[model samples]
Target: MSVRPPGECTAPDRRCILVIATVASFLTPFMSSSINIALPVIGAEFATDAVLLGWIQTAYLLASAICLVPFGRLADIHGMKKIFLTGITIFTLSTLLCGLSPTVNALIALRMVQGVGTAMIAVTAVAVLTAVFPAGERGRVLGINVAAVYTGLSMGPFLGGVLTQHLGWRSIFLVTVPLGLIAVALTLRARGEWSTPRDERFDLIGSVVYGTTLLALMYGLTLLPEATGFGLIAVGVVGIFLFLWQESHTESPVLQVRLFFENHVFTFSNIAALINYSATFAVSFLLSLYLQYNRGLDPQAAGLILLAQPVVQALISPAAGRLSDRVEPRIVSSVGMTLSAAGLALLTVLTEETPVPYILISLVVLGTGYALFSSPNTNAIMSSVEKRYYGVASATLATSRQVGMMLSMGIVMMIFSVVIGRVAITPAEHAPLLSSINLAFMLFAALCVVGIFFSLARGRVREDPHRA
Candidate 1:
């Protein structure tokens, strides 16, 4: 499958790709955010503690982060549509199995498989979009795709809450099955596939080292305050360095290491994404518990309250993405990061006495910042790379997100281990839980403040067309 230049592709072809990408984009985030609303119910049903409950999300993120790059490279070597179809099948089946999981352990395991499926879809969806659309129109389509993501996020809490409240937590996972089938049906009808022209051997050794090290690092983060955790983190860090060195020597690497050192826009944009997601990803997770346990709200009401952020994001993303095409992405994204810092800072003061309106106000601020940051930053990343590297670039973007989400959860898990310990969210543990949530928000605010610098440091995307 030789690649088609952006100008050469037909409008209908672009529309088909966008439809597939949009559905895929919506599906994964919907599952993730909806599950956040169901965590309390899941914990209650299974009689699990906070740390174990965190694993429900963390395990999926870890698996997706581990597989994204390898599967992305495979897509580059083979075909995006083939991998995309396979992923949809895997995701649909795994999601079905997840709903049937009788134990928390079984559910967690299935989520890992679901994550693997997610990795394939995550890597290809954006790459395919970038592949079909011209650079001038990239941000517009990317914004639309990103808006779809926010739509899923916005719906996740409300729909997830309704399903969880009325139909049980299992319904939240089961409902996605029909949507998955629809995506598969649409994708199968799409014509042609995309792949890199170059033929290179896959680097088996680098993939193993990369996967192993990341697993160790993320798992270690969850086990924090323990000497074993520190030891494993040290090993993971060292192993990553070794993996990079191996990539430099390998004939064909899973990750193209040179992209980071050579491309300022790519590197800093990715860094900004890491920091932004790290600061913001766990906001819903913490608040879901806070609303249910601390504020004594039902899942339905809590979800409506939680919908403020992503709704703002869904509304603003396309405009911001289009704006980035005209202005400097760094400037627009930096301002967004600043807003995020402000939002997270507001949440740091949250307590049982805090008003619901205050929380909603803070969420609106955070969502605005996220809306500004995500689309333009993504536009910068995809635009900075050449067509041949789209799969890798897309996967790198998704990997940054998964790793950031994993770290966000890791931060929460470590805090839980230390502040709340391995305890259920009984009224007895409420005080400690509040303390933990407040402290986490404080750290996240500080992190977002730092991310503003990186967002600016990514420089101008339009000027630095090094490869694009």
Candidate 2:
């Protein structure tokens, strides 16, 4: 069997790795953004309630976060290439199943399957990329990978809106099938594996603890201001403390809790990521609703207006990534948080009469801030770890992002329940919906403002491999 030698790293294998990783990176966000635009359509067809509609997004993110760290550890033990390929196969098949789903529950279930697949891919993708490229070039490639994510986001709404408007929402899932197949095929061509020890015991107890705790916490958040919600949340918090204690003692923990305590950069970067995502993931979802419900625009036109942010993100992420390699990631990421906070604060003033240009400008500001924050923050986390810890570190960062996404959605769910109740959105419901959106933006802005300090508190990255 022909294999690319480990020593041969300048171009051939590196380029191939980037292409495959970029494709995988693009696939999930495209599905997510496109699906967010289609949520109203899906609700209309199924006659679903608001709470269940929110679950369309929440279930996937919750599952992905719960499984990410475990899958990352498995990849570290078995082989990244194998795990990554398996994830692609599962994702492609699940996407097919999603297209064929006949009910809302069925679609949500298959999305959970897809979420498991996503966790696998997300955990290994960066680890594989990091393994292929040296540190000097790592930030550049990672930025490009991040750019592909934004590119998917950039196109998802427009493509999803068009497809949903014309061919139906099922087509959104169907279209991804071809792209996913190509990713699987490309991954198949790659040779070799990335795993260490080859015999580390899988931490089943830790996995159970982590997954249950997250599920409780996120699900509880969705039910906020309720008695059971508070109960569940309190239990979940205690569960987290217990999980940390268990991990500190485990011989082969699913996640190394100690890393967060030991590495300030890794810890704070992840904290910033969590806050940034919590403050941002729902922007597209909320805006889609606002444009369609309040502005009386079609999905296609609304998608075009919503395109401003991610387009900027796609264009600028690589440059920001490259910039991190030269300067301290903290400075760039902190500034990004500041910009993000400003943009979100602007969004708090949104009203039914808010102009098209104003919305576009806000998206641009938010996207630019995201571009600056994401790549550099990611660089800080990945670079701060040992080579053997790359898989876990990558998974941890992905976890932070996914958890934040879940929290973002949870906040939306709680607000909708309290403000609008569990009803389908209509013209008459516009005022309450607008109120909810405004309040959400205000809360997010405040959260991101706090993220600025965390981003800065990370201090300088420790570059010494020995320290890692």
Candidate 3:
């Protein structure tokens, strides 16, 4: 393997690293949504409840979110390639543990460990890519990375379903091992030194406080529907306050508080990402459940049907990213969000009797909108900050996505539970369940409207002055 200087790789060297980053990023989404198709099967095997099942996902998400900032900091301190390789190794080991887990609790614990590895890779992947590519060509390269992510997300359900149905749920975790090994090999081949290392200290206290707060908040939200009395609300309020106070005083805050005030583009872009992801999260999580339980579709069929959104997103993200480089991101993102809102609003009318083609069309529209919005919004966020802060900026963007997805799952579950309680029927009852599903979709559509406003506020930033 040929070694390249930091920030000055040969074409083949850069391409190699880019491929590795793309594959690593792909694993994150694959882990995220692949489990959804297998959730019911896993639940049956483990005799788990909805709340417990939710943790299977929440554990991974919360772990990944909590670790992203700190891991980014670590990457900056150490080397990106070194940290990335270590992360991939750990991720592979964790996947083995997950496959061998004998109980739901054990699986959740292993999933949390897997999430830490995922975060390490995710937080560093973009920074590595940015470092490898020249500024002028970065947009096109990053666009390809975005495309890979959507492709992974799109294929996850189908892959998971096929493995679960044919082999077993354990195969979902087992299959990732080979991919992780490939990522590690590529990472080693792409190794290079760090260009700069700051002497700044890691905010250990801030990380602990932030992690605790997010855990409490997500846990409280997850339990809100089932928890009676004032206990749940009290916990959530306390957690929020604690998080705020800790972040306010920390010298090196994990989440940069000042960024929210300093840059309108960053703030608005993050808000748009939050809302947009929340909408997509609901569709991914709930639709699988709806198809499997209500429509009595097998996991494979459900996964196939769910492919509409991701397939559309994969096709459009690269083009949208490239477009944002020429035109104003604000206009492009706003139009995309508006389209997403419209598509979700259309979902409000879906029923069990609705034809599969209609459902696929609606999802395709939603995916197209998401693809258009995601790349531009991400480009805006990444470009808004100084080059030195790229790692933190990427971590912040990812955290916004995680928070949105977590909130979406919690809120939707609460709505579904309340809707079920109010009616005298099971969720399998198509009419009443359809009404609840419509209500959720409408709520998501309203969120997209908010995202549109935020997207409109992302002011234009010119390309880098130092670019070749």
Q: Tell me, what's the RMSD of every candidate?
A: 2.7, 2.8, 3.8
lDDT of 3 at 377: 87
Encode model 1's per-residue lDDT on 212-312: one tens digit a residue: 99888887877888998999899999998999899888778888888888899999999999999999999999999999988888899999999999889
Cα deviation of 40 in candidate 2 (Å)? 1.2
What lDDT score belongs to each candidate, Candidate 1 first? 0.89, 0.87, 0.79
Winner of 1 and 3 under TM-score: 1
Per-model TM-score on C-alpha atoms: 0.92, 0.92, 0.88
Per-candidate clashes come to 0, 0, 0
By the TM-score metric, which is better: model 2 or model 3? 2
**lDDT (Cα) of model 1:** 0.89
Q: What does candidate 3's lDDT look like per residue over 1-468, in tens digits?
A: 444457667788888888888888888898787899988788778866555666788788878878877787777776677778888888989998999999999999999999889888887777788877888989788867877787789889999889888998899999988988898887777646533555677778777766776666676665556654136557667876776677778777766767776778888889999989888786877677678766878888998998888888888887998899898887788889998998898888877777889888889889889888988888888788877666667788888998788777766756656664433233445555566678889899998988887888666655433111
What's the CA error at residue 27 for candidate 2, in Å? 0.8
Point to the candidate with the largest lDDT.
Answer: 1
Better of 2 and 3 by lDDT: 2
